[model samples]
Target chain A: MTDDVAVLGAGLHPWGKWGRGFVAYGTAAARAALLDAGVGWREVGSIVGAATVRGGYPGHVAGATFAKALGWQGARAASVYAACASGAQAINTARAQILAGIADVVLVVGADSAPRGFFRPADGDRPDDPDWLRFRVLGATNPTYFGLYARRRMAVHGDTADDFARVKVKNAAVGALNPNARYRKRLTVEEVEASAVVADPLRLLDICATSDGGAAVVLSSMEFARRHGAAAPVRIRSVSTVTPRFPNTVLDLPDIATDSAVAVEPSGETFRSSIARTAYEEAGIGPDDLSLAEVYDLSTALELQWYEDLGLCAEGEAAKLLRAGATTLGGRIPVNVSGGLSSFGEAVPAQAIAQVCELTWQLRGDAGDRQVAGARVGITANQGLFGHGSAVIAVR
Target chain B: MPRVLTPVVSGWFAGDGDDFHLVGTRCSACGSVFFPREDVFCRNPGCEGGDLTETPLSGTGRIWSYTDTRYQPPSPYVTSPELPWRPYALVAVELEAERIVVLGQAVPGVTVADLAVGMEMRVVPGVLHEDAHTTWTTWHWRPTGVAG
Candidate 1:
């Protein structure tokens, strides 16, 4: 296993449609993280910000913006944008700095103020851009893709719409306990079924909404953590940012077509499966060793997809595992104990970092009612636009 | 005024009726094909490089998956504000020979109920939107047995 960086602090700005600028939420979360870490902003050697495209210039150069907002201490700054995986990429950047001895302590932050309704491509008549082409030509929104996946699962795995609702039901039960979650009300299967259909086979409640929120984490080298008296802090074990192999068969977000597999034979492993496998391989652990998981439940059915992709269960058995209550809290390998995107909606850049924040809290035995009992090893799995694959493993 | 007809993005597809086909680029060295037509280079990692030639994609393929948009899409996807929103089906078709999945709107009147995974589908030309002076033409996927 690679050398670990200590997660000294984790914090968040509660998710919702607050309609405020992303900087405010990010700064608040950064201050909270710094307070939790007991580290002064001046003490941080570097800062990495997960960028938000909608935030304009400041959001694009988020690292500098956050650094300036936190009172410029001349800390080294960097910004990264990987769509939904932005947070994980920022965390990975911080970890890299720590491991490389470039920074003793690094502050990682991600936040977004999302637009209402379906996410659309930036304005303009740029036919060269695939994101624009898909929307302009086919009008296929995000939920359309989710519906496609949900329907595919139904046809291939015998999964029903009821099974999809059960996932939302399971997550809502736990999400109600998370103070940071935007949607706290527990939902029933009937409510899910009654919700308006945004796309066929997937209702509005089955899909995650776009929201404003922020998350931040403080990381330090093991030596720095020891020096700061955080001798046994929750540690980040692995951060997998692997890209898809050639001939990616699955149609991912913002793409109009899958890679042609005519020349190269399809890799037996799918992209999502490879995401977790790489994390497991790097962390020197397996799914069996995971005490809990936080997967990007973009849609309730997609959560089940992650369950199988994470190797928590055999192929075509995710729904069976969900039905058996193996993925709920107090079940075998509990997934999304943080309420997931179903509860938090999506703050784009902040979501993945928030996943890690959940892991840190759980591993530290500080997650309150949502805690997975005896949680020791936690993994977060998320995929972003284009070919970005994100997964992080944390252990106490 | 008489409206002109044009492909939304030219060079993606051509021809008429049963003779119509989507255009893509095939790598001479690796035999890999790219949709939306990759003109610059081959995407295969194994092969050093190859000449990408314009090739017509298969006229028929099986539906990999299907869904429909229930709500109106945002800007860039033009919809008449005066008319009530109408949902349309979308299908991702898997070409057997090239082994690629291409997505497009289903022919009007087809909905999610009529589609199933692995059902045979074929591409055909259709109108995407219309302005005072122009009609935007694009591709649509239809069940092979269905009449246009």
Candidate 2:
């Protein structure tokens, strides 16, 4: 395993549409994390921000924006954008700096104020941009791709609409306990069934919504953690940021076609599976060691796909495991104990860090009503648009 | 009726009636093929960089997967805001010889209900959108049984 980076503290602003700037949410979350870690703004060696695309020009350079808003500590700053995995990539950057002895303490922040309705590309007539080209040529939107994957699952694995709704039911129940989740009401299968069909086989409730929220974490070297009188803090053992292998047959975002397998045989492991497998390999652990997991449930069916990709169950067995209650709270292993994107909606940049925050609480025996008892190890898996992969491993 | 103007990409198809073909580039280096015509460079990393030539994609292929657009897609997609939204089917086709999957719009009148995973489909021309000066054109996938 790589040199461990201790999670000194975790924080979040309750997720919802407050019609406020992402800066406010990010600032609040940052202050809370600083307070949780008991570190002064002047004490931080650096700050990294997950850039938001919706914030216009300033949003692209989030590091200085948040740092400037936090009163300019003159700390080294960096901004990163990895689509939905932006937050996780920021944390990974911090961990790299800490392990390399560049910083004793660092802060990572991600927040977003998303637009309502279907997410569209920036206004333009450029046919060269793949994102714009897809819309102009095929009218293919994000939900349409989600629909394709969901339907493909149904055809291949015999998964039904009920299975998709069950994921919503499970995550919403967890969200009800999560004070920071946007949609906290416990959802029922009936409610999910009643929701309008945004895409066939997937309803409005099955897909995540865009929202305003923020999450932050303070990370430090192991020595710094001990020196700060927190010797037994939760440690991040692995961060996997892998890319898809060539001849990737799975039709991912922004692509109108799959790479021809005619030239090269496809890899045995799919891109999603590789994300988690790389993390496990890095941490020298396996799925059996996980007490819980937080996977990107951009859509309900996608979460089930993660269950298989993360090796929580054998291929084609996610539906069986879900039906058996093995992935629910008080079951064999809890998935998305932190409400996931299904209930939390998507704050994009803040999501990856939020996953770690949940793990930190669960590992610390402080997750309250949604705690995974005796939790020792946890993993978070997410894939970003345009070929970015993210996963993290943490242990007590 | 006005004379049909060619779409932005050319030689992908020609003639009327039974003579439509989607054009693509075949890598002489590794024999890899790409749709929408990759003229700049071959995408295969392992290739020794040989002559890249334009080739006609097979007119027919089996459906690898399919989905329908249930909502009006956002722009650069040119749909009439004045008109009511009508959904269309999108199919990913697997050409056995080309060894690649190409995505296209299902022919008009086709909906998600009419599609199966392995149904046979052939490429055909369709209107993308129109302006006072020109009618934007595009390629679509139509089931072989459907006559134009």
- Highest TM-score model number: 1
What fraction of correct interface contacts does each candidate retain? 0.89, 0.66
Tens digits of per-residue lDDT, candidate 1, B48-109, equal 88899999999899998999999999988999999999999999999999999999999999
Which candidate leads the pack in lDDT? Answer: 1
Alpha-carbon lDDT of model 2: 0.88
> How well docked is model 2, in DockQ terms?
0.68
Candidate 1 lDDT over A252-341, as tens digits, reads 988889999988998899999999999999999999999999999999999999999999999999999999999999999899999999
lDDT by residue for model 2 (A307-396), tens? 999999999999999999999999898999898999888888988889998999999999999999999999999999988899999999
RMSD of 1: 0.7
Those runs of model 2 whose alpha carbons end farther than 4 Å from true positions after fitting are B1-16
